[model samples]
Target: MSSTSIIKVQVDDTQFKSFLDLYQEYQEHLESAPDDWKKVGDAIGDAGADMEDFADASKASKEFLLIAATQSEIISREIRKASAANNALLESLTKNVTAQKSFADQAERSEKHMKELKKGASEFAHEIFGLGSFLMRLGALGGSLAGLGGLLSGIGLKDLASSAVDTQRSARGLGMTPGQLTAFNQDFGTRYLDPGVLGSISSAQSSFSGRMWLARAAGENMGQVAGEDPGQLAANLAIRAHNWWVNTPASMRTAEVLQSTGFTQSGFNLNLMKQLGNTPLAELQRAAAQYGSDQGRFNVSDRNTDAWYGFLRQIKDAGNFIETHLTNKLSDLAGPLQHFADAVGKDVTVLIDQIFTPANLNALEDGINGFTKYLGSSQFQQDMKDFAGLVAAVAGAMRKAARFLGIDTSPSSSTNPASIPVNPGLDPDEVQRETRGQVRGYGGVSFADKALGYTRHKLNMPSDPRAVLAEMDAKNGLPAGTLEAMWAKESSEGKNLVGPVLRNGDQAIGDLQFTGAAWKDWGKGGDRWNFMDEAKSGGAYMGFLSKRYQGDIAKALAAYDWGRNVDKTIAQNGANWQKGLPAESMDYIKIAKILNSQKQNVRVTVQNSTAARVAVQIMRPQPNEHFYRLSVSV
Candidate 1:
């Protein structure tokens, strides 16, 4: 069941680019941190000078103060002690200022790193790219992420899935809001999401870049960029992408932009510079489209803006928030500065004598203690470090912009998925499994919805319907058209599956709408997908029931719908089993009679709501076997 669902994330992620811009702004923000910290040290020094001035003036007035005050020696000793501690506090402040400057300088210098992506960004890109590739690989098999894949991603209801953690905590974690990820999955047209997340059926962790992308896609109409105009949207993306490349110099195009697209399928793969790189917008859109039909065709560029400028706008916003946060935190140092200034701003004589008292000495002791703990607390240091690390990460991500941003157009053999996690739930999308290779001209939409839409087509009864019906007729040795009417009633000739993963027991599969339990119990151990297999297997069960019911076709059909337990109803009703039959089952017989010419072709479809299963799949045995097994097992 482990597979992947690719979002077809385009090249030139605007969110990522905006993140690059954030790196620039954050770098500027970090540069001032050292100087900002230096100002704090200077303020403390000025306060210290005020204390020294008071001490000097107090010495000049020492004789007068001795005349005015008792315990003069004690007062003198306290004055010396307080003055010495103030000096020590100033010296400690200077050292801290130097350390802060060093860290800020390093963070600032890291911004100048133009060639290499930092570790954080490298890790982020690895996960996102890995997840995308993982999805593509899983798309080959056809299952789902936690089996929630096709149903949720197909219809934009993936948001309903719970990200409940289980035995193992996830590797790459969820991004921000689950809603945004859901929107991104929908807008991005992804069926499967996340990697290496167990216990979670749908979502995986959102890496830093991924968080910004999902957030941007979810925010303020960003995900709605595909506004009801597919043709125009496709044209707009092509024009804008080409316009951005118009200013590019030959050297950059040759060195950087040439190999940008690589093997990644989505994004602006347009190469204006190359002699043969000219892929027309219409043709390019056509090539990228999943299915050829008008409704089914999906031009990745034409579909959504989560991969382009909208993403960039979000990155800029996030960067602004980070920059403002750092500057605001630094400005808070003014409070301590003002506190010290107020203490030293007092009048000379009264303050000088008061400064020698026990309370004032203790206050001085507090100020000195404040130099280490208040100015250089562990919390503040950690905050600075965290912000600095993030700021440095912005620079790291910027370096990768050149490599992944449509500069490389050549297809590579494979991608490096080492950085991405491997989630066991990664599986094929719901469409592939439900359709089972028979693409009905519908874009990879939900199979159940597809069937419901084709209700009229089923009622008309296409040529293919006769093939399975004839097989059932020949196998069961029953009257012709009996199974045809039944098939039409159940699923309009296999037009729909029960649910995406056959998740509901009431929902069934194949031409017969066989529940997992019924398929296993009566299908005679053949491929459930094959129409002949289902027909023959189903016919034998019907034949057996027909013999048991004394050649009564109506009684046998009822037994098929209500399970073997329907015998209780027949026994209770004695010779008149039809007396106990529900209206829904009675309709089933009447329609079969009409279609097969056992009676008139009155109604086009039959009603058999009593379809039941008495067993379940062995995977995780359910308590109630009568309740039936779900399609998720199938």
Candidate 2:
């Protein structure tokens, strides 16, 4: 399988803003006037009651009454100061939370990238190990050859061959004519073959050396005369014949050559002599060489008595060792050769094992440790964090610019960083004109002027539709509760983005239930996104929809659900537009209409108990009042 690289999850500015908004809301709720504030007032009142009772019981204790009044005033002042301090703290916490979340995002990307690098390094180490093992095996083969070569050097082939060759006599004995013998002797003296080969054979003092010499001679001569390459068996026989011919005394040379040619004295053959005489000189020499070469074939060099034979002993002993101990089963090996082989093999095997032992594996550990050291260093970590921060900052500026120009620059879940929006379409002015539209609210006030915080009454919507809708309306001029209610009807505000695929197998994504094509065209540019990105895409598209349908939310929503078909139906049917559309489209329109109707009853308001509101309420008291009432009645 091909290696898998780690993926980075990008969160753009638009997405961060959405998450920040939600988190801020939760933090606001937490920092609101805690329920225990009432208990402080109740405690003061009880203390005041006790003081009054003590004064009454003591008849003339004005000092106790004065002390009680002073303490109450001081406690009330401290409470006000604490309330102010809490609001400041909440603001500080908000900023820290945003930065920490961004840092966490950077960390995740670094971890995934490191994982990919580690996997690649592991594969490389495995390949290196395999190469090391092969080299070790090759070393073993070389060691075996070196041992055999050492034994061969002990045999003195050079000294023997120097004294042995009488090339002229030997060549003439083989019946080479006077001219032929002279040429042969000249080639022998110049060491055309090997000058020391004759001495090496003579030192062996065995039939085996004689056979080896003749075989070598025949092979050399055969290549010269007929260009016929001799096999191992033919070469062995021919060299032996040459060894015998070269060693014989000069006077007996011709007789030995004739005897080798199959001419026998017991036969007393004048006819044989006549037959030999009839033969041409070249034919007679060739016949004699062949007869002597063939006779040498039966000689066994290593088995017969021979002088100190270093080369032959080394070759013979090593071949036997391999056959008995190495190639064959271990149990079948015998004698000192087997014991020597076992000792060498064991030593080599142990060496190989040591190379890969746990102690040695520290070398491999050092490699991985070095990789991790670089990855986890402060400099590297800071670089990654700084890069993420830079991207977020740049993205924020781009998003702000895009928003000003009315482009839907939002987060996309595409892992490819290139797909993230930097600067979107050309013509910012035209884009703004197409995107943003004026939104009017109750009594002709701009949507931006209206506050929906007061309308946070309980509702059955999946989330707080009034609060979110009001915020969108004020900030982006969306019809209040329109996007929220549309979301409630479409996908319960993105709760089902990953599930409940359409019967046609198309997945509805984001709060507005954008199909794949709709998301591509208007929602945002990505294959996937978090809930915050989905919300931004859904909100951005709603603004564009408002512009397209001339600020008629109901019809624009109908078009959003029905696509171009709604426009076509309306054009053809006029007053009966709903009738001309498909049943699914008609049902979609009904659902959107129902949502629109429900949002009408929802008052545009915010949660009354927010920290800022509670603090203001606490600070505002009647000017003449020395004591403020605490509502501990509940």
Candidate 3:
């Protein structure tokens, strides 16, 4: 649909205003009449009482007073009855007025919608007429031709005409005009072609073109038929006939007319509108005015007037009965309800006041300030600062411990730092100097020396070479400190020889022979275990020996032989030793030979012990102590 075709209907401001005025007047009449009625009734009752009092006086006053009292009572009763009737009439009038106003508003909306629909329909008809005219003219122009060449020319023209008609027809059907169709065709091109048009033109180069010509002729003829206007004479005759039909009275009811009328009656009762009209606001006002002006006499004797007054009093009393009872009950309920309402109102008012007032906002600000003040207190600040400091201290200690353990302790510097080489080239002179200094005399210093030295310095111990070495041995799990402690304890017990003998014979012998030999071999040969080699292999050898010598005397002997051979080799070949060996050559030839020999010897000894009751003796001689021997035959 075109954007312009979308109708936006506006309400009639004047009609709305008039309806609003009527509504306001109706509401005012409804609200004010009850109080006015009550006031009038009260006045009438007061006047009647005054007249009655006068009527009860002496004979000279009796005649005038009785008439006055009678008239007063009559008038009071009439006035009260009139007020009540007027109140009822006013209430009904208000309701009718509201309904009428709503009806008027709805009628206005319906009228606006009707106008929009009529406008749309008129535009649609106009577009259809324009499209039909264009198609009819195009068809007539294209159809006047003959011969093969003429037929081809005619086919082309007819195809063009048919396409134009189809395009126009589609636009018109879709509620668009030729101008809009043209614009759409230009904007969207072949996209807007009717599917039938496209399919017809698709194979039209064959005999389908002839069929298309026939179809086009038929469509064009249909368009012409649709476009034709009826003769003026016929239109005039139709109008005259419609006027005559409308003017003529029905002699007898036709079936269609009867059905239509019955349908109308069923849908809406027309007589109801007429009846409502009779009791409309204007008619009711006229009736009320006439009733007031007539002043028709009701039975006016003194007794009758008294009776009427009594009747009115009874009616008034009846009306007031519920009100009186309600008033008493409501009076009882009023205090509590009013108190509750007051409390609710006060609470609502306080909430509103807090929402709108700056003072409450200031109180909120004060609360926030109090919280901030608490946060900023010396104790809180100090606690936070201490916590931060403690965290820093813990982090620093952790970093120091990691460094002491030779862990990678570098802090992350940046999220995307430049990638640096892990082993950047060192200065050749500095490397050579480090290498030469690192390779000391016959026994090369280890990487553990610096680590051990660091530990000793941190412990605030004397920088003795042996102390550092002892610490290194202990750190490497050699139990040197335990041996020293045991030796000291034995000396204190005057058992010096025992500790020495145990140390030299077994534990110390094992260390000096196995571990010491391995260290010597590592230093001399420049093998992986060689301390002179940058990649020290002694640690690796120890790990291997630890596994091999897991839990047997054979292992201890092997370790001792390994150490002895390593020490002997180091003593034989000085600093320049391992120069002739290939990179992949083994370092344990001598140790292996010694272990093999020891294994064979031990096996023979065990065999001999089993064959003969060989006695094994352990002898120890001490100064100022007897030599003792302990022997066991196995």
TM-score leader = 1
Task: Give the per-residue lDDT of model 3 (tens digit) for 1-634.
Answer: 5567568787869988999999999999999999999999999999999888766765657778889999999999999999999999999999999999999999999999999999999999886455455445645644542243376444354344444555555544533333344433332233212223322222221244333332232233323322322111112212222333344355532434422332112111223222223333443333333323322221123344344445545645754784576568557756556665676688899889769678878988999999899898998889886676556655656666757765445532322212322222222111111111111222223224323322333344234434543454344333233223222222221121111111111111111111233335444444222111311232334334444444222232223222333323345665533342222112322333333353322112323625567776666633212224566666
lDDT of each: 0.49, 0.48, 0.41
Off by over 4 Å in 2: 1-470, 473-476, 499-507, 595-634
Ranked by lDDT, the better of candidates 1 and 3 is 1
The segments of candidate 3 whose C-alpha lies over 4 angstroms from its true place after superposition are: 1-616, 619-630
Return the lDDT, model 3, position 583.
Answer: 21
Once model 2 is optimally superposed onto the true structure by TM-score, how far is the C-alpha of residue 69 displaced, in angstroms?
Answer: 28
Compute each candidate's TM-score over C-alphas: 0.24, 0.23, 0.12
The residue-by-residue lDDT of candidate 2 on 495-578, one tens digit each, is 443322232223444445555545666555643334444456666666666677666565666666655555776799888877
Off by over 4 Å in 1: 1-464, 499-506, 525-529, 595-634
Q: Which ten residues in a row have the lowest lDDT in candidate 2?
A: 432-441
TM-score for predicted model 3 compared with the true structure: 0.12
